[model samples]
Target: MSDTALGKDRRFPFGLTIATLIAFAILIGLGAWQIKRLAWKQDLLARIEVLKTAPAQPLATALANAQGRDLTWTRVSVDCAPAQPATLPLVYGIRDGDIVWRATALCRATVGGYGAVLLDLGVVKALTGQSAPAPVALAAPARAVGVLMAPRQLGGDREATVQKFAAERPAPYILMVETATPVPPGVTPAPLPAEISNRHLEYALTWFGLAVTLLFIYAAMLWRKMRS
Candidate 1:
């Protein structure tokens, strides 16, 4: 066959090749990122499991020991004076398969010199039709034992929430009250999550599988072009 006719029969798939290479790189990059995520998730899960059973420490001691480290899931105890009625922020949430509101308050910490701490009093079942329940008073001081959790952004209004519950300088972590003496009225403490899902490995495999499949398809296309 003449060179001109041969070229027409088997023109290089330049555009298709470029597109395929870009897609393959993206898939591979995604897979690598997922692998890194998998490692991080595994470490977090392990830390949570250990923290769940560790004996509770005084909140002041825990804070001192943390030294700027992540305090999430660490169990601690604190004594809290009753919070002001207006400072309570009812965060929307779900618990035990029911729509509920998480009752939170900023209270004076008798120990740790924390000045104040945000206490998650617990879940208040949403009224019929998922309406928010009426706010209630926190009238009793309590000795609370709970896990310290990072404050969740309430609809991106974390700054507003902080300002609403103003204190000398509030504790950075929220104390999710597990047990308290003279429990606050009309609110149940939310339970720790029963399980945290770890699916990064599966996601990594999926991305990698797509990249390999693309390579196979590209090779087949190249074979057909060469034969033609």
Candidate 2:
């Protein structure tokens, strides 16, 4: 047998070493990616903190100022008249550890910047396999004081209902109602979450720790091979 083959077979695990190197590279890459994610998440949380507490602006002014910028979590006020109650959509969600449907509707904004805006009126609770609650009637021409948020993806049926209002060219953001004059019946205004978890740093540390552990394991295997 050749010297190289004999050496690989008796003294070194060439194939195993190559596999370990590949796995180590993958683990390190994952760790680095997580670090980048950690930075991004931190920045987002910081921005949200500042925007949520600043004085509320008019919806039109907020939209204009937010041009080419993120407007999520910006408190805004608008005079909106809810569309027909029967056509409103119910988006599925969880609130207070119970299943609930978020009541959503397209409202005609009096401001000129946007023809219409989407509103999250509140939540309606119902159990699984139960029929949805009756649609609540929102008082007309409400002064909606709320924070603007980016819309989340919806299920097919609910998405279809929202699309029905697309012709109105509603603002891209949804106003999560904090308060409105003459509130809609049987609905609770669900605003921005009280706390947004920032666990990216912890996740990044875990990924890095795993990478170091892999290196130690690889080194131990080589040590055993050399000793033998």
Best-performing candidate as measured by TM-score: 1
Q: Residue 22's C-alpha lDDT in candidate 1?
A: 100
For model 2 the local lDDT of residue 12 reads: 69
User: So what's the TM-score on candidate 2?
Assistant: 0.81
The positional error of residue 208 in candidate 1, measured at the CA in angstroms, is 0.9
lDDT, candidate 1, equals 0.76
Off by over 4 Å in 1: 1-5, 82-87, 110-113, 126-129, 139-141, 152-159
Cα error of candidate 2 at position 72, Å: 1.1
Estimate, for each residue in 1-228, the C-alpha lDDT of model 1 and write its tens digit: 999999887988888899999999999999999999999989988887897688989998988778679888889988766554654656766455666777676668744556877777777644422764776555434688888887662243444666665655888777888887777666677647645789999999999999999999999999998898
Model 2 lDDT tens row, 1-228: 787866765676778889878887887787788789878878877876796678888999988877588787788888866455544666766555666777776678855466888778777543322356554544433677888777653333544554677788778777888887667766678776646677766777787788788888988988877765
Best by lDDT: 1
Ten contiguous residues minimizing lDDT sum, candidate 1: 151-160
Which lDDT value does model 1 have at 138? 57
